[model samples]
Target: MEIIIGPLILVAQVALNLFWWALVISAILSWLVAFNVINTSNQFVNSVGSFLYSITEPALRPIRRFVPPLGGLDMSFIVLLLIILFVQNVLARLQYSIG
Candidate 1:
């Protein structure tokens, strides 16, 4: 049981780290789109944007509901990233305590 649980925790940590990168990528993509630096009509750009949206939207939507954007600058992404970091820290502490 210890062996199995240890590997599971490591996998979870990796997953959270990957998710953190995804959120960062999504935020940057959004900025590019907003600034018209990337053309959404292009198939590749559109597809990538869609993929990012699908991945990040589920987590961000709820946050958006309660915290509306201020002056057209959305802070929800930042807030979500911070939340993910906090969760990652807690998970790390749990793994340390267990081991």
Candidate 2:
């Protein structure tokens, strides 16, 4: 069990880390666009923004349902970040225990 579960947990942790970065990037990109600091009209900018939205939106949508945005400030992404962190920590602990 340890042989299989250990690697699985590690993979899960890595996946969570990648996802956390993606969410952070998506939020920052959105802010840049909102502030007019970055022009989405550029092909690369538009493509990146669209890709980020497509990947992150599914994870964010359910969280948005309950938390919503507060005073026009969206906290869903932050909430998701917290959840991802929690899961990653748990996975690390489990991996350690198994190893």
Among these predictions, the greatest lDDT belongs to: 2
For model 1, where is the 10-residue window of minimal lDDT? 1-10
lDDT of each: 0.88, 0.92
Q: Let me know the TM-score candidate 2 reaches against the reference structure.
A: 0.97
Query: What value of lDDT does candidate 2 attain over all alpha carbons?
Result: 0.92
Error of 2 at 19 (Å): 0.5
Candidate 1 clash pair list: none
lDDT of 1: 0.88
* Model 2 agreement with the true structure over 23-78: per-residue lDDT tens digits: 99999999999999999999999999999999999999999999978899999999
For all candidates, the clash counts are 0, 0
lDDT of 1 by residue, 1-99 (tens): 767877888898898889889899988988999999998999998998899889889999999998999999888898998998898898888788888
**Candidate 1, which segments miss by more than 4 Å at Cα?**
none
